[model samples]
Target: MPVILPTSIINILSNLFCILINISLFYLYTFKIFYSFQENEISISLQIIGIIVNFQEILLRFFVGYYDKGEIIQDKQLILLNTLNFNFFYDLFYLATLILSQIIMYNQKNSSNLVVYFLNLIYFLKAISVNKILNKVDQLLYITAKADYIYQLLKLIFKLIIICHIVAVAWHLLAQIETNYFEKNNTWLHDLNLVDSQWYSRYIESFYWSTTTIIILAGPKGSNNIEIIFQSVIMFATMGTFAYTMNCIGVILDEQNRKQKEYKRDLEIINIYMRKNNLKKSLQQKVSNFLEYLYQEKGDIQVNKNSIEVLNKLPQNLKDDINVEINSKIIQKFKLISTNFSQKIIQEVIPFIQEECFLPNEIIYKHYQYDNLAIYWISKGKVQIEHQQENAKIVLVKVLEKGDCFSEYQFFTGKQHEYQTRSADFTTIYKIQRDKFIQTIQKYADDYEYFNMIKDQLIFRNGSIYTNIQCLICKSRYHRENECEQIHINKNKQLTILKHLRNQIQISRKPFFRKCFYFIKTIQLIKSCELCVNQIKNNQELFNLIKYIDINNNSMDLDQSLSDNYIQDKVIKNRDNSNSSLSSTSIENNVNDICKQTLKNFKNSIIINSEQINSNDNFKHSQGNKNQLEIKKELQNINLLTCIIFINIQIKRQTDQQLKKQAQIQIRIQKKQIFKNQSIQKKKKKFLQKKNLKQENPQKKYNYLFKIKQTKKNTQVIITQQKKKLVI
Candidate 1:
């Protein structure tokens, strides 16, 4: 049977294998002690293993998926393209060098040290592959174990160890160069008397010297300027390393103790607040106990506050699922909800189920209290339902344990509580407020109707429920009967004469006939006032009199004339013969005669005035005809100027009309083009639909095609009609 390893296991194994190969190659290259082995078998074997590891890693890059941002990219082509980039070339070069060096050593039997050094350098570059191992290890530590402080501490320690190892290797390499290349006798190896030491001893001495100098700044004396310079450089690098290590340790310790510190600070703040408020000892003790219990129940985080923020950040579906999971137990407590509702309806209400904790013997509500009317379900501990008797003594009604609900009757009926509720023990309750629950269920019409029906049935079975008395004026349940009396008083105060006039004016302004009627009434009022009549005459207001007469004639005509004649005759007769009135026929005749005589006299006066003006103008003309010619010439010039202006206005009007017509024609053409495009799109969609129908249902294919042809005929008719209209 073939073993199929999981992706995580495969990744871990590959990372470990790469780390082992890199470390082994690093050690062999650094020490070079295996060079003394027969035929250099150990070194050759290590190099071969490294070449194999590198080749496999490069191959895996083409097959294995990689993470880009947060998403895993598993496309084979993408993997191959990415593998051919910079890392691929570097790996290929390293592999070729290893192979070449191995061949040279095998062929020569005694290859130059340069080839080995070159191989060492190439392997040193391969050390960067250990990053993959560190990354996987980091994921295991921080994600799997969820110990950030531990991961950070391990990271800092690993970095320090790598730095120490590199420094040790560099120190030994420098010593080798000084002694072997420069032929010097005053190197660090000579000073320590380790020139003839075993490979292990030399390595131990170099590591010890590097660690002491980097960490404590104390080691064996340097015998040359080159050694001193190297020590100084190491000292400077050590300063930075030490600073970084201290900072990492500080952060790790702080993270480990953060929760404890927060808890202590909160406890101290609560105590200080209690002391500042001068609260009673028993009350303070109760508060402290509740705080302690809260911490024990919810741990370091404030679950209610933090959970609300977390739930808000989550998607709607996830939030709904979480709410249902946490509060599904309390859902069965409600009779209406459990019997009449489905799981879907219950899920809608779950989001509004808020969890609250109560201390032992704490009063959740009192008898007859109108506020805090919510249905409560006991999820943990017990609740004591109490009632107040006629004698004002509290009686225990019942003890409601887990899965029991209370206050549901008051919530549905909008009534005050009949009995008080107190916690018998440290209880946890899931409460759903009446308003929120009603609003949420209202979104689903069927659910809301069924809920209402079920609520009514439940209320009927539970005996009489108190209903609020609604006010008659405002039609609100919250207003008292006495408060309605003030509305009547305010209405009466607002209905004064000025207010009535304003309302009539506003009404008159709304309609044409009302406005005309109002204008006629105002004219009648002005006619009745003698002072207004005199003012009109003095102002040459004949047009006002004529307009008033024309309006009266249009409305009343003959009756208005008869009334005026009768009134005038009555007034004249009264002056001539006291306590006497004239007949209607005589009054009408007398008024007509008086009007004719006045007209004749006015005509004679106008004729006489015209003759006098003509006589005066002829006398002036005899005195100077030259002045008359100059006046005629000035009049001709004024007439010509007026004619030119009128012609220019006519030309401008013609141009404006032509431009307006052109704009209208362009707009109509653009609209027709848009309609054509829309029609074409519709025809294409219909044809596509017919093709799809032909594949799905062969029988419907002919029907769909006929429909499409009918639609095309109708569209063509519409286009032709539109074109004829545009031409017209």
Candidate 2:
């Protein structure tokens, strides 16, 4: 059976332990040398340990409702509350200190107060430490452990009383245990069980001796008696009970931690497994299914360990840190493992004959360089090995475009070169350094255990050169991020990533797609689905293309028309570029024509939806402004509304709460005033009657019934007035 105990019992035990430490300190100091810190290795070690003790003190205060300065002062309560990261190490250090002081004093020479303080400190440390260990062990089982912190606190005072009793017992026991070493051992009282029969003994020493006999109960060892057997039985029972309790606590804590680990693993596995699977499920169906599951199936399954011990291999932590080992195990055991990085790396390094380009009349390799010791892979265009002799023909080696590895037979045989390597025109090929090539074929290179498999493959060095991959502008503009900060280009947007380029500048003026894409990609994340690159043909096509894109998915809600002010600015800026300047009337007519053409196309497209158009009432929209202006307005409003709503909600809640509290306070004050007024009226009526009677006859008033002015309760007011008058 479990040793079930209330918080009150635990509190009693805790405070008893605290008193034990403090009392031991005081007793040792009085009997032995007055204690001082060594100021050497022991002291430094203690100080280092003391820092942790201070932190533990802070932690205890926090748990005991001492958070603020005022709370700390007000807190008479002590609590054994388990919290984040207990100071076990600090408690151990304090225990070590208490034990050391006691041991040293027993060996050496003592003052009464110092010994008492020492004992008290020792008892305090023990009680607190015991409380913590039990508290933490209980909470690990998810039990409610706080109880009533204040009540437990008051119980601590009784623990000090218990400590005082225990310490006197320990002090006498120590003196008896070391009787041979003591100089004053021949005292008459030492031989007598002075307090055994006499509770009325005059000496305090008798009380100490009797208490020690009860706690330790040491008598002649071999002399058996029923009383001695009963004492031993009690001691044995306590030992058995504590051991059993600790054992049970340990088992529950282990199971709880294991379940937590398994649950975390299951959550991660579900996320990883579902991500790809969730994508294929239709969005509308997935959302519906998810909602249904949340309401119906959420509690059906419990969290399990994601990874199984089907194969008794590496632990999860090791597998995670060293992925190669896990991947190897997965591939060998399962036949295939889908790892994105492995797939990407294999694509990069797979041996193949690949592509190359050649300019006219450039040499691929010269005659002198073509020794039989090495091979050349003519992976691409027009390879010719030329003779070193004067006016020699540059013979075209088999023009290996692709899927071609050359000179393998000659390379391994160490034969003299039949031909030299040069370009028929200009050519490129992957050349394998023979020695290095041989070294690479020695195992997985990384898989040191499998060196034999690579030995034969090393002889034929297959090599190729492929065109390095590049980004192309197809729909979305491709741009390098580095170019966005060019001094001549716009710097209006310090944050280059999210700012819409077209909104800031004209289509022609904005950075090219190649530059912008890379720029934005660096600053902000571009989801793969969102990126579609399109190259510009010229100004007109670029403008028309830029115009139609509801590219900023957030921009489906704009008036895709040019404004009058924008048109006027455009006319003024472009007046010099065109053959002739237009009058204001001409410009307005041209703008009108432009608006008609732009609006006609814009109205036909369903890209600009109605919902985003009417989102803001304060911002005016027009038919002539381009779609970019509308995107600008919507984004601006989004920011402003977000800020306004945030501030408004915070202020409104605080004001409402404040007003509620004030109304309650006012109501309370009014009620109090009303009661006081009623009492005062009754008193005033009584006083008037007494005055009227006194006037009718000679005054006859009872002394106890006479009024005393409330203000006259404190005479300090008269003193303050007198001081002020004297100063004046």
Candidate 3:
């Protein structure tokens, strides 16, 4: 047969074993130090080891919540009821109890056995009482750990308490050593009456003395001036430590009291608000019940509606700083907000969020009854997102705990609400309205198109089907209902890129021409897509091309007949100058071939531009005119400013090029006329010289001077004729 012990006995034995193990390990560790080193080395080494272990244990508890990392195991349902300092307190208490019990049992010769038994019983009871207090402290630590700063403060307090206890124990040890040193020599300074015979009794007596000195109470009398001086210094330190500890405790208590008062004041204000508004009985009751639930869950109510309103009225930067300091972590933990946006955006958004509270089982919104409006971030308690069926039955879709968000999909998508949300308990949330959200995002978003892309992605993710909706102008989505001004803006950008592409093709070197052409073709291809197509159709500026342009899949035909006629007339003029034998039929055919090739070269561009203008009609739908007009006006102002700057630069460049070309052409013409005049003069002079040479040889030789004069006269006459012709 197996023997079994009761659970209570087993637990007590287990605790005793743990205490024994700690003491044995500490003894062995101290013994190792004493054995391996000299006396002075041992003292310093032990001090170093104690300090290291104390801080190391504290840091481990602070960071990992345990002294030993390997002992930690994650369990969802497990609740830790022990604190970091509990182990230190428990060990010290157990050691003191054991020593006291041993002393009481052995010192019975001086007292009755019954009195010793009663003292032991009292000692055990006191141990139990201290254990109960430690257990309560452990429970309190569990709650404080939920708050980061509070948890750290609590840990710091525990560390201080342990440090003080260690100091007290060290003081007791020092006092025992001092007493032993004086008593063994039979010195007059040693008071045998104050010192106990047993080492344990002496240590206990020293501990009581040390406690009195540490608390700034009456302490042991000193024997000499030197002792008195040392006691005075120790007394001063004790007073400072006591004061510091008291200040810390007072500060913590004051903070707790302040928070409690604030909570109570908020509840009163909420009651007043409800009365002023003359809210319905059901609504008032809901608020009342929520206040009660809050107290139960959090042990305090925090109704800050007035505070939120005050914060909202402050400067935006100040408001943002305050909200971020308080609620940044609460907002960042939500999946939608964290994954979709950056920290800066989150910071900007923090100011717009409103703190809201909901009662248990309170309906936030019903499915199909409200549009996708606001997003709710749970800061405390829980909420249930329920999907209501067509038959009016509700199914719980998800239970969102603290740090989760509700209606987030709606905020991103602009879709109608798909589900209803209800508070599962007393809940607090940070609410961000859709319009405010959009306004905030527009500040950081690059442009309306980028913003629209985010919107589309959100809508698609939420399972909204967008196919089969025809936008006649842009030939994309159903623009009449959607009414996106961004479509117009994007169309303007595509046109700007097309114009830039043309400029690059004209100015770029031959080696880059092919690349430029390919790039233009790519832009044109992109422009033919749904977004750009809608942009071109809806925009007032780009809508004019539809009246006289035709775009086919393979061939671009934009005002083809007019272009053919222009090409033929140009060819005819060229023929007249260089080919007089060119027939009308040959000229027309040549012009047609040239036109065909030019069209082929620019076929991609024409098709893309014409595709933008395929639809002749305009959209009549308009919504949010003030907002759209304001944005449009702002864009127009920006574009006009940029265009003015760029156009002036371009005009200046073109004027310089034209002046340079004209100057070069004039210089070349003057050079040609000069050469022609010089040749004519030389010819005339040569002819006159030949005639003079013939006359001079045999009476037929003419006077060279007369010949020269005649030639000059001839040259002068020619020059005069040219001058008259030029003047005419």
Task: Give candidate 1 regions above 4 Å deviation.
Answer: 1-117, 128-136, 254-299, 302-728
lDDT of each: 0.67, 0.41, 0.53
List residue ranges in candidate 3 displaced over 4 A: 1-39, 44-189, 193-207, 210-296, 300-319, 325-350, 353-359, 366-372, 386-398, 401-404, 412-419, 443-447, 450-728
Tell me model 2's lDDT, rounded to 2 decimals.
0.41
Q: List, residue by residue over 1-728, the lDDT tens digit for candidate 1.
A: 12222245565567568667877776676565322223367777777888888777666666677666534677777766766888679768878877887787777766556776577567666763556557766664553466556767887887777777778877887888898899999998898788877777877887888878877887766779988899888989887987779787997899768766766788889989999999899998898777767566554235566868978987786777777877787677665566665677787777788888777788888989997779887878899978687899997756788987777666777778877899987688878888887787788889778767645644554332223223434545443323455444444455675676674434445544534443437765455455434533653333343354344335333533454453445444545223212232343344345435534654565566557656775566544566455445434433443354346435534643554465456557767999999999999998888678867977688777688799999999999999999999
Please give the lDDT score at residue 55 for candidate 3: 40
Clashes of 1: 0
Candidate 2 lDDT at 316 equals: 58
Supply candidate 1's per-residue lDDT for 347: 77
Estimate candidate 2's RMSD in Å: 40.9
lDDT of 1: 0.67
Q: Order the candidates by TM-score, highest first — what do you get? A: 1, 3, 2
Q: lDDT per residue, candidate 3, 336-370, as tens digits?
A: 55555666667777766677777778888887655
* Candidate with the greatest TM-score versus the true structure: 1
* Residue ranges of candidate 2 with Cα displaced over 4 Å: 1-52, 59-129, 133-233, 239-243, 246-728
> 1-728, model 2: which lDDT tens digit per residue?
12223233443444344434334443333233212212245533543444344444434433332223212222233333322235545555665665565455446533234663565365454543334534443443233344333433333433333443444444344444344355444332344543133223412553453334433555222122432454365346434544554455556567646655655565566556667576554664565444444333222223112223422266555544444443333322211112211343332222321223444455544444544244455433555534344666443323444434455434443434544555554344544444443444333444322222222232232211111111111111222221333323655465665565436544676665554443436433333212222122233533453343323212212211323333344344654323222332343354345445644544444246444455655555563245555545444433443354345335534643554465456557767999999999999998998787667644344432343343465566888999999999
